[model samples]
Each structure stands twice: as structure tokens, then as C-alpha cells.
Target: MAFFCQTDSYATELLTEVVSCSPAQLKTENGGKKETLSGYNVILKDTVLFPEGGGQPDDRGLIGEVPVHRVTRQGPEAVHFVSSLLDPGSEVLVKVDWNRRFDHMQQHSGQHLITAIADSLYGYKTTSWELGRQRSFIELDTPTMTTEQAEAIEQLVNQKIRQRVPVIVRVITTDDPEFNQVRSRGLPDDHAGPVRIIDIEGVDANMCCGTHVANLSDLQVIKILGTEKGKKNKTNLIFLAGERVLKYAARSYSVEKSLTALLKNGPEEHIEAVEKLQKSVKTLQKNNLTLLRDLAVLTAQSFKNSPDRSKIFSLHRKEGDNEFMNIIANEIGTEDTIVFLTVGDEKTSGLFLLAGPPEIIDQVGPRAAKILDGKGAGKKGRFQGKANKMSQRGEVESLLQGVLNGTAPKEE
Candidate 1:
């Protein structure tokens, strides 16, 4: 059935009677699972709420004190989902959420203006458009759009808005000759009856059923955010209209102020200051790495001269890495020596490294990793892996010692 909002877009509240009310169930998918929701489906004799259709969201509001959570069109009826059932043939007061309705109207009308201008000036036909909560986008048939072309279209659209052009809505039969002139995505297969056309003064005339403002000036402003490459060689033009544009501008200003204070520079100097700081940090990191390598060499030299150095060596460093442990093992220079190293702090999982003769590594490497509940692979004589059970470092050391003493099981 035809809705009152199709013609009287400014109405917010209606005194109507309920034609039918029945218990209803809606099925929806959540996290890859299907679920059913129980509610009452109410049909009103007249309503101001716009049902979900034409890429626009449904209008939400209260119906005689009970909240209407969702409104959708099924066949010829506008189905309102309510928590409780309303009495059939009972008189009711239906109110639409004006803020949400106006926002949708602004975005929908702005999209029509943009789509019309793009086609008239550049021959880029609009394939689709989406009216989002914070922003909207129109997909063009072209593969790409240059910055200059987008700016020019934005300028032209704003100029039309400044003209305060009248936005006229008219219902015409499908047989009317002017119907062919109206730019439309095309009527639905099941659509019948009189077609509604929106005429923007001398600018555009298009077939649309969505609510729109009475004048172009009601859009306040239209700001083109940018464009992105869409599926199948199409360009999606991102834009914000009316109140959304103001909200975006305010958010950008807040971020700029925060950056200016944190960087100790003006807005224009932020990039240069950040680049210089990054270069300085890189230089310091390089120096720190050189010191770590030198420390590893000195530590290995001290261990090399130890009189108690055995065929199998077991050591644990409070805060060392696999690279440091490997360097130390390589410096030992004894072909028969084996090194079992665990390095980390009390707060972290730490790492384990086993470097030694090929025969010993092949036999005990996988066993050592199993004790630590980790995994590793060995090549030549080195094996390394992360040990998530840091407190079990002592257990790993003891297992390696058993292999050295020939007490551990041999790999058969």
C-alpha cells in the first residue's frame, strides 16, 4: 500500500487506527547461526514511519507509548515489529523519529543531486548508492575519478544548493510521456500504479520513492570526502551532507589540536617534526645493537677460559636473546662442546637455544623442546624455539644434562 510519507514528507505524527495485529516471528543470522525473534506485527491505517526500502533504513519511533523497533514492507503492508500486540481497529498515535528521518532525507536528496550532476557533466552513470548513518556513497560506472573532476562536481552541486531550487514531487501514470525522461534505476518487477518523480527545478527529474526535503537548501551543505576503487571498475564517491558534515569537521579539528600540542609544533609542521624524530630514534637503536653484540663477545671470552667447562654446558641469562646465546656458543670454538641456553625475564615466556654436535642435537633437541611445551627444528648443530612455560626452564636444563650423562632415552 502507498504510505503517507511518499507525498507528505514533513509529517511526523499521525492519528490512525490499527487495521490488523498478529503475533509474528522474524528469522535473522548472527555469527553464522540462524535465530528467530518473536514479536507482534502491527498494520496501521495510516503511518508517518517510512518502511525499509530502496537502500534506505527504516524509520523508528513510538506507537501509542509502545516502542516500534523495526518497520519493513512485506507485500502490500508496512509491518511494524512491536514488543506487545495492539488491538485490531483500535485508534492509535504514531510518531516518527524526526532526527533520523531528516538525516536520511538529507543524504538521499544529496545523492540524487550528485548522481544527476555526474551523469549530465561527465556521462558517468550511477550504478548504485548507499545512505549510511555517518556518510553516504554513490558508485559510478567509471573505473576512476581524478581529484579535479571530483572537486568540480562538488562545486557544481553546492552551487545548485545555494540557488534554493524547489524540490517538487509528483505522481504520474506509467503511460505518461515524461516518464521516459526521468532518470531512474528502473522500476521494480512487481511495482505497479502511479510512478513518483522528484523534480529539482531546472537541474534534474528522477523517479524515487524515498523521502526528501522540500528545497535543495535544506541539505545545508555537501562535502565530498573522497573516492575509492569499487568492485568491477566502479568508483565509490564518499560524501557527507548537512549535520554529518559538521560533525566530521568538528572531529577533525579535535584531532588537529591534540597533535599540535603533543608534537610541540603547528599543524603545518607536524609531518617534518615527526620525520626528524624518527631518524633520531633509528640512530639510537643502531648504537644499542652494536653494544649488545660487543657484550656477547666479552661474555663468551670469559666462559671459554673456565677450568670447569664440560662437554655439555648449561647456562641461563636473566635477559638475553637467541642471537646473543648463539654468538656465545659459536665463540666457544670447541667441536665437542654443547650449549643449552635459556634467556628471559620473570615477566616473559623467554626463549631456548640448544647448540652442539650434530649427533647430540639430533637426539636430544626435540626432547628438550617437548619438556618446555614448545617446538623447534635443528640444522647442522643449532636448535631454537620459544618456551611458553618460563618457570620450567630448570626442568629443561636438567633434561639436557641427563642426555649429556647418557641417562636419557636414545632415539631408536
Candidate 2:
């Protein structure tokens, strides 16, 4: 069995013959405008565009102008899968996006440093990971950690970054006891081939298929962006690596600057400014209630002064909320009088009616309902109903006057 290092693994071998490509090549993809590439399965070449059984994304570029859609390892063979048809023995140029490759390297390397720090300092291990397009996250075995503990790990990662320790990738056979002795996020039992171990001297070691930086310094930074509660005893952590950290910082600063202008406050006063605004809103709500109460009293007095007084009377008004109707009815309600009020906007209406003895609410209540296009049942003289529209107020007032004077029939 042979063991390959990280540096040598990237180089492609000369292909004397072509074996296969995926159906994707024929369709044209990977930013290519072409139609397809030949060979479906076995690109029997020592050089490979396929990213093997690693969890990392496949390498994408061109295999002689044909897009290499994907790369997967089958058993012991390396396959060069392409997206467009290609002729056998065709001599073609291969291009790989080194920038993308290096970005993956930085992220993978950062994961190792952080994982090692967590395991060494707190006995927590990374259980799983999701490498997304815009962001990436790792799940840890423990559900939660104190901010102090996480900060310590973060500090350790920075220390390692500054130290610039070398990162080594080597393959060891299952038969090797040294491989079993390593404490890592262990590999799957089904992975029977040579076990690839990533070792950072005096820092951390793990089994991984993803690419990584040659040294810790290449990572630049490993920032844990945030954490969220995961399964029973795990927590998920979001992180940024290398150039992403720089990008995140730039974007965050821009947001802060814009917020400062909108809020009319400096960073130190932002929180205070927001809190003050909330307090002002509450004060305005309280003051509004006081004003409504005063207005309702004045309106009720005007109704009492009118010569068209009836045994049952109601006033329809529009105001902020249902509170206004209740206030008006209660202010005019006396032992022998019933005053009903309905208040609302075009959207909806609310009713409040009060009765006092000589309180013939029962006799007049139903009449009020009929006039308002609403229904309510009560004895004596008190009744209330929601009118369909504001225009119904006049009809409602006229019906109450007729019922009180005995000039109109009450039952219907």
C-alpha cells in the first residue's frame, strides 16, 4: 500500500486512455456553455479532476475545455468525470480554480485547530459539519458551553494561528496500530481503504478527506460566528475562515455605520437611543387615554342638553378604540336612564349600552337592534347592536326617539 501526502495529491497524472464521464458532461454545466463531454464512468487516468470520497466538494474547472462535473472514487480507482463528450486519446489542458481550492484548505485547517482546542480544553468533539456556500457550521457533542470556555478556545486558536504550525496529511493502513491509537473524530467503519490522517504537530489530529492549508498561518483567522442549541447534548457552531472573516468584518462594520446614522447616535449610545424611543411610545399611549376620557365626558354632556331626550338613547361616535364607547355610555348612565353608544371605523363596530330604572331597556332594546341592523335581546329598555356602517347612526338615533315616544312599534 502507498501513502500520498497533501502536496502530491493535487497533481494530475498523464492519461494514456479515456474511460468514462458522467451524463452531466453531455448537458453542459460547471459554468461551461458547451453541450456535453464523453466517457460516463471510468476516466482511467493517473491524473484526476474528480474529488474522491472526501466530504469536501468536488474540484470544478475544465478538462480540455470540457467541464469536469464531478469526481468520485469507486473502490480503488480514481475517475475523471466530465460534462461534455470527449474523444479518447485527446490531449487536453486541465484547469483547476486554485483560489477555491485554497479557500477550502483554509476552512478545513481552521476546523482542525478549533476542534483540537475544544477537545483538549473541554473534552468536547466535533460530531458533524455542514459546508455551505455562504457559511459553514460544525456540531459539537456537548449542547452548551459557557462564554468564557468558548472564548478560551478561541484564544487558543488564535495562538496556534500566530504560531504558524505545519499541517501534515498522511495515509495509514488499518493494520497500523498507530492509526488506531489516534484520538480523533473517528472514521467510518465501512471505510476500509488506507486511513488518511491530518496531523498538526503539538496541536491536533483527525481523519479527513478535505483539503487544508500547508500551515496554520495560512488560515489568517478562525472566528466562531455564533452558536445554537442542537440535539440533546450537542450545539452547532457557525464559523468563518480566512478571506471570509475579512468579508464578514467589512459587512458588519458597514451595517453598524448605517445604523448609527439612522438612530442618530454613536455606538455607545445606540442602545440608550432605542430604549428612549420605546419609552416615548408608551408615554404617548397613556396621554392618549386621558384625552379620550375628557372628550367622552364632553360629548355625553351635549347629548343630555338636547330636547329630543328619550327613554333609551344612544350616541354613535368614532375614536381610537372600544375604550371610548365604554367611557361615553358609563358617563351618562344613571339610575333611571339607559345610554347606549356604538363606536368604530369602516372596518368594524363596537357597542356599549347602559340602563337605569324607569330603565325600560327590555321594551326599547330590540328596537335599537333593528335600527342598527344588529340584534340583541334584553328586558326593560336597554339594548345594543353593531351597525354595519357609520351612516346607520342617524337611523339608529331616530328609531330610539320613536320607541321612547310610543309613536313607533317596538316588537318588529
Candidate 3:
């Protein structure tokens, strides 16, 4: 059935009777997250709220005093999911979210314009389209479009908008001659209403059930942002229409201003400035790694040169990484002294490594890692893996100490 929206896209409010109301399971969005809800499924005699269909989304509005979060098509009825139940025989004000309604209207009709123009000029049939939150895209059967071709298409679309072409909806039955004339992908098996043909005056007409603007001028302007690769070797033509174009322009200018301040350069030179900054960052990182290596060597030497010459060495660096830890372990000589090296926050997650004799590393490495709430693997007397709780390093030190003292416990 053709809902009120398909018939009059501009109508924002209607006084309608609640035909039926029943308890049902529902989903409502809270702060952009969906939650399962227990609510009333209200069937209104008539509604301005459009159900989600035809690649367009459902409408959000009010049914009397209750907020209608969801509306869906069930056969010929538009089901309004609401928090409060309205009496079956009572009349209620069904108000459409006009801003959202008009935005969808603009994009849905804008799609028609794009589809018609693309097909007429390049014989590129629109396979499908999506009305995304940020931008909309229509997938064309063609593989690609050149810069010149895309420009020509966008030029023609805006030209038609400038011409202020009237967009008229025609309702026709199966027996009507125009029924066979309009372009259609095909109708649903359950489609029960007269076919809708949206005619863009002197442009084109196609069979569609979605809501649209009354005129091309209502679209304001359509900006074909660019094209992207699509599945099946098709091309998706991305675009923004009406207020979206204005919004995008405003956001882009804002970003440019912020970049100019942060980069200390005009928009024209921002790219070069960013490139130079990136190169400088890379050089600094290289120098930092070299310093870490030098520190690792000196630390290992401190252990070797000490009078005690400790057999079990334990070290943790909050700023170091796996590479730094490995360098220290390698310099200490894994043949005799057992080295336990960790790099990261002492009380949180980080990497760990163990180095010692073949038999000792096999036994102590995995045990030490487990004690530190971690895991590891060993080969040629070297074992390393990640640890979640670096706070247990002391327990691991005691375990290694027991091994050095020949008092380690037997494997379980």
C-alpha cells in the first residue's frame, strides 16, 4: 500500500485513529546504541511516519504524547513502536520528524536524478543505492568513470536543479499503458498497491516506492564528491545533496582553519609542512632506538662487572620495548646468568623475556611468565612473550632465586 509519505512527502502531521495496540518486543536506540525493549506495537488507521523501505530508512516521530522510535511495514499497515499505548478507538496526533523526513526526501529524490542522468548519458544503469549518514552512493553497473566524464555528469545534474524541474508522482494500475513504460527493477511479490512512477519533468521517470521532493529545486544542489570501487567491478558514485552539501562545506572550512593554526602554515603549504614534520619525527625515533641499545649494553655490563656477579638478573624499564629487552638479554650471555627483562608499566601489561641455560630456561622461563600472569616459548635457551600483570615480577624473581639455589620445586 502507498503510505501517506509516498502520496505527500511534505506532510509532517496527521490526526489518525489507533486501529489496534498490543504488547510486543521492540528495540529502541539510546545514545546511538540499540536496546531490546518491552513496548506497544500500535497500528494506526493512517500515518505520516514512513517505514524503512526502498533503500531509505524509517521515520522517527511522535504518536500522540509518546515518542515513536520505530515504524515498520507489515503487509498494508504501518506499525508504530511506542513506549505508551494509545486506546484502540482514540484519535492521536501523528507528527513526523520533519527535518529527518525532508532530508530523506532530498536524498531519495536526488538519487532518482543521478540514476536517470547516469543511464541517459553513459548507459550506466544504477544497480543500487545507499543513503548513508555522511554521504550517499549509487552503484552503477559500469566499472569506472573518468574525471571528465564524472565532471560532465555532475554539471548536468546541477544544471537540471538550476532549471527547477518539477518532480511529479504518478499512480498507475497494471492495466494502464504507462505501467509497462516506466523503468523498474521489479516489484515485490507482496506489493499490493498501484505502481508509483516518479517523473522528473523532461528528465526521466522510474518505478519507485520511496518518498521524494516536489521539485528538483528543492534539492538545492547535488555535489558528486567522487567515485569508489564497488563489488562486482561496479562503480559507486558518492554524493551529498541539499543541506548536506552546505554542512560538508562548513566542516571542511573548519578543518582547514584548524590545520592552518596547528601546522603554522596556509592550506596551500600544509602538505609540505606535514611531510617535513613527519621526517623529523622519524629521525628522532631512530635516535631514541640507538640510545636504548646503548643503555641495554651498559646495563648488561653493570651486572657482569659487579663484584657479586649475580647469576639471576631482574630488570624492568617503563619506557623500553621488546627490542630493548632482547638487546640486554643478548649482551648478558645466556650461557650462565639467567636474565629476566621486562619493558613497560610495572603494574600493568607489557612484554617479558628470559635467557639462561637450555634446561634452566625451559623450566624457569615458562614458570616465571606464568607467575607474572603471562606466557612464553623457549628455544636455544631464550624465551619471550607478553605479560598482562607486570606487578608480579617480584614473585618471578623469587622463583628464579629458588632455581639458582637448587631448591626449585618439581614440575607438577
Top model by TM-score, which number?
3
Give the winner by TM-score: 1 or 2: 1
User: What tens-digit string does per-residue lDDT give for candidate 3 at 1-412?
Assistant: 6877778989999888999999988866889998899888999888999998888899999987799978988878889888887899998999999999899999999999999999999999999999998899999998988878888889999999999999999989988998888888888777886888999998988888888999999999999999999989999999999999999999999999999999988999999999999999999999999999999999988888899887888899998888898888888888888998888889999989988898988888878788878878879899999999999998888888998898878768
TM-score of 3: 0.89
- What lDDT does candidate 3 reach at residue 239? 93
Q: How far off is residue 106 in model 3, in Å?
A: 1.4
* Candidate 1 wrongly placed segments (more than 4 Å): 20-38, 278-412
Per-residue CA lDDT of model 1 for 1-412, tens digit only, reads: 4698776888998999999989988776889999888889999987889988777889999899999888987766788999888999899999999999999989999998999899888999999999886889999999999999999999999999999989999889999999998888888777878888889988889998789999999999999999999889999999999889989999999998998999999999989988998999999878766776787788778778888867767667775777878888888753788888788863357788888888878777888887777788878888888877667767766776777787866545
TM-score versus the correct structure, for each prediction:
0.74, 0.60, 0.89
Clash number for candidate 3? 0
Candidate 1's error at 281, in angstroms? 4.8
- Taking the tens digit of each residue's C-alpha lDDT, what string does model 2 give over 97-131? 66666666677777778878888999988887776
Candidate scoring better on TM-score of 1 and 3: 3
